[model samples]
Target: MTKRQRFLQRTRSRLFSKGAPDYILLALVVILVLFGLVMVYDASVIVASETYGDQFRFLKLQTVWVLVGAAAFAFTYLFDYHNYPKLIVPAIVTTIVLLVLVVFAGPLVFGSRRWFSIGVVNIQPSELAKLTFTVYLACWLAKQKQRSGNLKEAFTQHLKTELLPFAFILFTICFLIIVEPDLGTTAVVAFTALAVYFISGTDALHTLGSFFIIAVMGVLGVLAAIISPYRASRVSTFLETIKSGYAPDPWISGYQINQVLIAIGSGGLFGIGFGESRQKFFYLVGNSAFTDTIFAVYAEEFGFVGDVVLVLAFLMFVSRGLRIARNAHDRLGSLLATGITVWIGLQAFLNIAANIALGPLTGIPLPFFSYGGSSMVVVLAGVGILLNVSKSSEKAVFR
Candidate 1:
């Protein structure tokens, strides 16, 4: 058999493995999902009732998603993550096809082509990319081996074997996503993949090269935002607000962030109390009180103490995930653990930062806390995969 076929044969031989799951990791995910459901209902009740004539519309829809996410979590948690290499190619193709289809066939919403309308459900291809592309990168990186210790030969070998293919795939996937004008998701995917690649080995050249590529992509994203009319307006608003202290048109241009600040500011020591946020009524961006800005409404209801608790929960979750990565049984498991952990951690940080004005509004979900079925399902699936990796950690490590 050929070297390629041999690699597949040897790698695929370990089809499955079993071990005790990380209960701490499991507990953190459970807490977040349950808390998210409660907040979805609390934040979405007013608008859901007004538009759908049912205060429980979003809550009910979210509950259905939670159930779907549970099944996805269970499947990924039990399945061997080492078997990912056998399926990575097909997964890559599906991810690309879905991304292209969404851009062409999906309805445009708010000037961006990001999701498909499937009979009372919206699936964001960009979100799916977050999971699939990570799997692709982890599998690819796990297979890479240094050709020769000779620095010159090694550099050239790395370029030919790793960097070239990586750049091509990275640019292609990112091109499709940037066309959707979804920079937030693109950044998360790009950085997560880069982390997996860098963690796969300690090649200084590869690390620097990957960082350079992502930096170039970041520059391109900035240029794209500057050129688009709607995105330009956002850039201008962000600059105007940060430089001075207000937007030119407070009620129109700066409304969302203004409302976010208002909600956060009014939520003093103990907050106005649960479900008692006045901003959730009509002050925030109508229905978005439940989506991109849910954190603001959460802050309004729970106060500073609540914010500290939530932040600490996320910190602990990330710490445990990294520990799992450090103790993974194999290269694939370690990189897989790293990729999943970084993806979720970075997305959560971006969402929270945007809410608090630490960064410009990126319209990304707060993982489990956001009220989107696709997002909830995708995130939980990733968590499930992380948990799967944890099962293979150094004997009873986190058990």
Candidate 2:
């Protein structure tokens, strides 16, 4: 064969050798995003018109963010996954600086300084923190394993020398996030970090110890909420609604959840038809129709069938992610993939649970389905890294 032909043959072999990126995973993401865009428009049109005199105002902004997220996804997907470990330090530093900046100089929206207003875009540093911390922890744990080996002495020594520092950093980040009074984001970040730690082959004793620390922190969080009347009222309201099966004052304390239930119930089985939700017509107050309670609007429009499909989509996404982690090329890849998966999956669960009043009202956004630019961009970027990890998986190559 000619030299050029031989070179082309080798290139084809190499390109085809790893199979293709997880197309099923990619397809599920695309369906969710496209459906999200439609639902965002459906849920926000009236609110946008009332606030901005344009029905498509939020829709136009969300479209821009979706484009930005797509660009982010492409960049991360094509980039080498192994390079992330090397960049972990810089990523953590940037997260810290941004978190500090948001606390000191960021604009306070709704009495919390969680976002920095950057011209037309508002950046949430906490969102980026979740991704960065996962990368950092995964890299650190992987390196420790390499240095220490699997001997019990080595594991103990590593914990003595490394675990304290890791715990301190984790605690600091969690403290900073909770001080933003965003307990929801704090919970997601902590859960993601702990998941990465657990999957890194930490010993059972250490795992139990870590869980104890987490439980204590959780209790403190509940106490903190109860101490604040505004927050305590939310908890009590949720409890009352649960016990009574209805809110006493739909226009007052339990407004959002009540409206969400109404939207969900009004759909019966098949939904009220797309963009035909009655709750979005000023019946649901605040940002329920668009952000916090978008799922309710979606259910109201598409019904139980749509809800089932959405749940299955998320389940498939998680299944694909876990499979990628199991077949990842190395420990770091596996842990990073696992961390990203847990973050997305747990956050989605919390959002949906809160809407259904299965948990206290915490303003956690549904992953791809929520209408928030910062969340959409960060999550899509994480998905890009996940896809890159899948590309590097030995099992993925054959499949």
Residues 40-141, model 1: lDDT tens digits: 999999998888899999999999999999999988888888788998899889999999998899898888988899898999988988888998999998
The lDDT of model 1 is: 0.84
Q: At residue 189, what lDDT does model 2 achieve?
A: 85
Minimum summed lDDT over a 10-residue window in model 2 is located at 223-232
The residue pairs that clash in candidate 1, if any, are none
Show where candidate 1 strays beyond 4 Å: 1-18, 395-399
TM agreement with the true structure for every prediction: 0.92, 0.90
Q: How many backbone clashes can be found in candidate 2? A: 0
Compare the candidates by lDDT and give the number of the best one: 1
Off by over 4 Å in 2: 1-19, 146-158, 226-228
Model 1: per-residue Cα lDDT at residue 338: 92
Give the alpha-carbon lDDT of every model. Answer: 0.84, 0.82
